[model samples]
Target: MLKIRNLVGGYTNTPIINGVDFEISKGEFFVLLGPNGSGKSTIFKLITGQLPCQKGEISINDKSLSSFSKLEKAKKVAVLSQEVQISFDYTVEEIISLGRFPHQKGLFKTLSVEDKEVIEEVMEITKVKQYRDTQFRMISGGEKQRVLLAKVLAQQPEVLLLDEPTNHLDIKHTFQMLDLLKEWQQTKGLTIFAILHDLNVAALYADRIALLHKGSFLDVGDVDTLRKESQLETVYEVKVNAQSHPTVPKPQLLMTPNHSKTKSELLNFDTSFSITKNDQFIHVQFESPLRTISNGVIGEGIQWLKHFCNFHVEKHYNGSNPKQDLQKWMEKYEIPFEQSVAMMTAVRLEDVVIVTKQIEDIKVIAVVTAGTGNAVDITNSSLSQSHEKVGTINSMVFIDAHFTDGALVNGFMSATEAKVKALHDLNVKDPETNTMATSTSTDALLLAVTQQGKETQYAGSGTVVGKVIGQTVYEATHKAVQKYFHRLQK
Candidate 1:
């Protein structure tokens, strides 16, 4: 456990750390975050006794830091700074052996069996065992960082302090280092205090964070509390958008650049999409990539796409892996699979309906293909009929405006409701239940936005963007359903 109360210190008479207070609990991964020259390293120096504390007290395990002698402190704390300099050309094993000096006894200070075991263990854990006989200066920068980490771990100190521990490592090695540290923190019950500049990594690993700004502690709390856009923007003096991580319950900050647009670019909301149709499929290519949310065969979930496709399939088309089939189809057509949203429908591609609407500066385009071969009243669908291929109705809505996350979700809801309304008006029925069909068994929908023009905060049914989306989807779905039924009658 480390504690600081009213801690103030600096290199000179003037204080860089102006009276800040905090504590790091045992086995806690506590991270310190701040802009450059924000006294983060100064605080680290003050705690490590590299700089004298000018004001209040710093204690480890309830004992004042000043009370610990050089060797005693080395046993209790180990520091892995941003850089380490050694005049002699020591081997990797020799560098790690130095950490055991504080624990060695007798004037000879020989390496005991326990010291050798610890040294080997640290080298193995840090993945530096292969380089144990090599000169420390001969390795790469990242490898040198890992070697230094091994040296500190060999000390077996109760508390570990790191300054930008991953600065010299690449993405792969960065995660590996942090993963090792996290494992040691849990297994060995080691306390870790680190200064990190990558907020997302801190958000992922830090048990708690302290934001240092202008020689003072601005806030100390969990990642969720400190990762707010307002807090980060003020502390770092840059614009940031904080969004939830896709697969985790953590918040990640995305930096927003100041990109200026010309007057023509800003006002050009009427950009047309090129539609290429064939008996096999219908592809619509946009002028630029659009921010999208979809439940398609490919390019599902949140994506940025320039191509949208409705692939025509037979009524009995039941491929075991439709996604793989769609990928191959896209490849055959020379369409980039990663930059496309594709869906399959039993309906004819020639019968696909397209509608466009513009309300003020915001424009909405809706595309639909419909069939009733496997319609289902979702609330009354049979269990035996649940497993079906792609649904008959495939709908997509595109908006030429910026949309917040909430607006994108709300727009999807509005479009779905409009489609259901169109079905209800047409008296489409689920033949098995003899009741009105709410939707197909596995309907797919896509909502995409240009992510330019004015920002829309909400797009519920009552909002202007939502209204346009609803009207366009309803009209397109209605016309597509009529064409499907008309073809059946023929």
Candidate 2:
């Protein structure tokens, strides 16, 4: 429904969207991706009539965008900009109702049933109904964004133009809002043009991505075509690696680290327990050295576990002399004896899922205890049947080990394959069972699995197991616990 060819525009009367070209089909979710100053917002402005398109052709449904007047543009499409300022004291309903202004005839135009229904439906979809009568300024930034979304939805235009719409939003709200838009695009056939700075989100949602570098369209294609190991480095001037989202079958991108962040800039030290009768409770000791940042945040690195799980953190690390920087966090967080912990985080709550399953053929069972906590499993639990009910924790992580939070799959063959790979890489093995272990370091969320029952012994690092305890345990435990603790996040 939207098409741009050799499009060029920018704020300075200078070119920002240099020679960009692409076509988005009807109801497709299109995304514009680039660095902070790459002029993504300018492209949105030029298309929305806020700024003139200095060069190139912009069209909606084969008609030139430049042909539309201000009112005409509003009739054709809705634009939600990145930088918005709201100083009005109007109620949420009033603000969303304002979206209907363009469609109104005069000041006294009577509200139609259609308009009323549209307003109510938009409010409900955007979840601004609770604040429908509340003053717009009183809500949080995220809630206010939703209200604005309601206003845009109220516009009832055929297409959407959003710039960093998910900025400042929490994961839940981001997913909810985007999910609503996705539904609209599917059922209502609304075309979308969104400016996204997050590669992962872009990868997950966009139908096609236009990657921009210093004021230029470096590449344009679907998620797979746009995400590549080498080209991404050239566009962002940062290293990145691509991997498949095991479940979604999409091309997921992870930025590679320069490693120059610091000796402590990107670092993690984690230890797991044997989880034997002698040590039913695992003792985990983590040492994270901190490197100062313009902003205190960690980076996700693949070859390293940091990138996959987003365990990036900002903490104070004393190097000249080994001070207790890491110790203070361990003590401060009060990690339970068998609980998991996540480090360098500002707040903690429940977002953990415990999944258990049964693999009867192996004559073994597995229980995986995982949360958004700071615990990593070492081994042996891969063969045991019963999972643990250990407490929660938060900590800095080393991704070279197994996760307890929802990472295991259902089938034993694949799970065994992953385990064998991890064990081979870690050079660790089960003395009796002789099965290899699987390992990953991403910190997004975690799962910890413990196996109980049966005579299980580790044999070697490369041996493959026909039966899996981790899978069985994951199948058995996840759902009920997921529902009970989902609201822990504040």
Candidate 3:
């Protein structure tokens, strides 16, 4: 464990870090964050005794840093700086063997059996064993970084101090280096105090973080508490958007650039819809990509899509892997799979309904293709037999406005509610249970937004935008369902 009390020091009489105090628990991964001139590296130098402390005391395990001699400090602490200058072409093995200097006995400073074992173990852990016999200067930047890490680990100290250890490493090596440090911290109880520039990486690995700005500690807390948009924007002098990571529980920050747009440009943002239908499929194309949330056979979940497809299949279509089949169909058609959202419907493509409505500056477009042959009353559907046919109802709602994540979800719910209302009013029923059907067994709904107009926070049924969405969806679904029934009568 390390502790700093009223730490104050800098290069000259003027101190870069002033009156800073914090404690690092044993085996804790603590990260220091700041801008270029925020005194992060100066603090690191002051703690390592490279620069004399003007006033205050730094101690490790209740022992003053001033009391530890050069050899004793080397045994307790190891430092891996951002860059190391090597004038002589030293072999990787020879460079790593130098870490055993403090542990060696007598005047010769020769490597003993324990020292050799430590060197080999460090090389293996750092994944630099193959480059052991090569010259350190001849390796790539990432390789040299790993070799330097092996050299420091050869010291086998209790605490490690790293200054931008992954600055020069690529994405793969960056994760590799952090993963190694994290494992060592968990297994060997090694304390880590590092200065990192990447906020997202720090969020993933650091146990605690300290935000420094203008010679003072702005904040020191966990990732959730410290990594706020307002705090980060003020410190870094840029606009930022903070959102939760999709797969992980941690928060991530996205930097937003400052760009200007004219009012005419915003108003003229193209959201025109184009539909092309044939016996095989119906395709809807948009001028630009829309932020979407859907549960379709392809392009499910959150995505940015420019094309929407509803592929027509036979009434008895029962593919074991419908998603793979849809993907193959897309490939055969030469569709850009990554930029499209698709679903399969057993209903006739000619019976589809499309409606577009404009309310003041906001606009909504609703598309629906409906049938009740495989409908299911979800409340009592558990008693019904399984149906493997394609979904009967496939609906898409497009809005020419910006939406938050909550608003997008609320809009989807509103659209679904409107579709059920349309079915209830039309007196549609499930063929098996003969009860009023809520939806098809595999109904798919997509909600997309142009994300260009005014920002709408909530899109519930009560909101203005939600009202338009519900009305448009209800009208479209009602017309489509009637058209399907008309076709059956013939």
| CA deviation > 4 Å runs, candidate 2 | 105-107, 260-490
What does candidate 1's lDDT look like per residue over 127-175, in tens digits?
9999999998899999999999999999988999999999999989989
Which prediction has more favorable lDDT, 2 or 3?
Answer: 3
lDDT of 2: 0.56
Model 3, 1-490: lDDT tens digits are 8999899999899999999999999999999999999999999999988899999899999899889999999999999988866778999899898888889999888899999999999999889999989998888888888888988888888889999999889989999999999999999999999999899999889999999999889999988854578988888998988878888888788888888556655534343667788878888888778899999888898788989988998888889999888889888887776888999988889888988887777788888998877788887736554555434899988898899888999999999999999999999877677889899887889998988867888998998888899999999999998998888899
Clashing pairs in 1: none
Say which candidate scores most in TM-score.
1
Clash count in backbone of candidate 3? 0
Query: Comparing candidate 2 with candidate 3, which one achieves the higher TM-score?
Result: 3
Q: How much does candidate 1 score in TM-score?
A: 0.96
Give the runs in model 1 whose Cα sits over 4 Å from its true position. 264-269, 386-391
Alpha-carbon RMSD of each model: 1.7, 16.0, 1.9
Question: Quick one: best lDDT, which candidate?
Answer: 1
Which runs in model 3 stand beyond 4 Å of their true positions?
263-271, 381-385, 389-391
